[model samples]
Target: MLDLNYILSSDYYKKELERIDRDNSVEQGLYFIIQSLLRSTIEEKYWVTDISTRSKKHIGFSKSVPDLTILEDGKTLFNPIAVAEIKYFPWSKKEYLTNNERQVKSYLKQVDKVIYTNGIEWIFLYGKGGSLERKESICLGNDRNTPESYYECINKKKLLSQIHWKNESDFKVSWDDLICKLGAFLK
Candidate 1:
C-alpha cells in the first residue's frame, strides 16, 4: 500500500507535475508518480521498479522493457504484483479509454493487478472470479480546462483506503492497510 497523503502532499510530486505540464507530456507525469510510489517506503517495505521479464512471445529476441512493474511477496507467486501502462492525451480528447480486461489479463499471465492511465482518467483491472474485473473512470482532478493541468487517479477505498488530497494528515492509514492486504494475499 502507498501513502496517498504523503504522495499527494509532497512538494516533490507537485514540482514534478509542474515540470511535466511545462513539457506537455502526460507520460512523463505518470512516470514520475509511479517512481515516487516505488520509492515510497511503507513499514519497511519498498516497491521494486521495472522488474523486467521476457515476454512469452518468441520473436527470437532477448528481453524487452515494459513501462513499469511492481513486485511484492504477497499474491504474486514470485512474480510482479502490479503492471501499469501510462498514456497521454490532449484536452481535445473527450474520452479516455483502455482495454483493461485484455491488458490486465495479458499482464496477469505474468503478474497480478493491471492498471492503465492517461493522466486524466485511470482504469484498474484485477483478477476476480477467474476473470478480470474493472474499476473505471477515476478522475484525479477537474482542472481539465488547461491543456497542461495534471490529472491522476484518485485513491479509492477498493484500491487502498480513504485518501486526503494535498495533506500529510493520515497518509499512513492507507499505506499500512495496503501493506497488510498485500501480506495476507501473499501468505
Candidate 2:
C-alpha cells in the first residue's frame, strides 16, 4: 500500500500546478498527478530530462515535453524495467486519440509499460505493441456533478482491481481517490 497524504500536499507539486499555463489545464493537472506519483513513490533510479531529444534519432521527430519519462532497473539490456507516459485530459473523448505510431513505437521500444492520462482519467498502454490494458478516473472539481458514492467505488480496491481497459469500457476513479492514491505513492 502507498501513502496518500504527502503527495496531495506536496509543495513541489503545488508550485508546478501554479506555474502551469491555464490554457493547458488538462495537461497541467495530469502532469501534476503523474509527477507527484513518481516523486512520492517509484524511487526513480534514473530519469532523462529531455526524452524527446533522446528519442529523436529513432523516431525522426521530437516532442516539446512528453509530460514525464522514467526508467526502472532491467534484468537484460533488451528489456526495460518500467516505462510510462501520462497525458492529461479534462474529460474522456475520442478526439484526444494518440495515433502517433512513431512516438508510440519509440516509447514501447524503450520501456515496458506506457501509461497515459487526462486529469480525469488514466489509461495504461503496456507491452511492446502498446496495448491499452487498464484505465482509472479521478474524482475532481469537474466530477462534482457526479454522485458522491461514485468516489467510494474507486476507494474500494476490490472494485478498482477488477477493472480492465481491454473491454473498451471507461474506467472511473474519483478525483478524491486519484489524490489519495497519488498521496500514497508520493510518500
lDDT of 1: 0.45
Native-to-model Cα distance after best TM-score fit, residue 13 in candidate 1, in Å: 2.1
What lDDT tens digits, residue by residue, belong to model 1 across residues 1-187? 8545433344454455544544444455557665554445332343545433445342121223346656553523245556666665333335433333344455655544655654434455566432665443344433332332444322111222122232343434433443344334322
Collision count for each candidate, in order: 2, 16
**Residues 1-187 of candidate 2: C-alpha lDDT, one tens digit per residue:** 9755524443344334333323233344445455555555455454322243344444322332244655433433233344445543223355444454455555655554554554334444555544444444343322222223534433433311121122112222343355555433312
Best by lDDT: 1
TM-score for each of the candidates: 0.51, 0.46
Error of 1 at 98 (Å): 4.1
> TM-score: which candidate is best?
1
The 10 consecutive residues of candidate 1 with the worst lDDT sum are 154-163
Off by over 4 Å in 2: 1-33, 44-50, 53-55, 58-67, 73-80, 86-92, 98-102, 130-187
Query: Listing every candidate in turn, what is its Cα RMSD in Å to the true structure after a full C-alpha superposition?
Result: 9.8, 12.0
Where model 1 places Cα greater than 4 Å from the true spot, the runs are 1-11, 24-29, 41-43, 51-66, 73-78, 91-101, 119-122, 128-130, 142-187
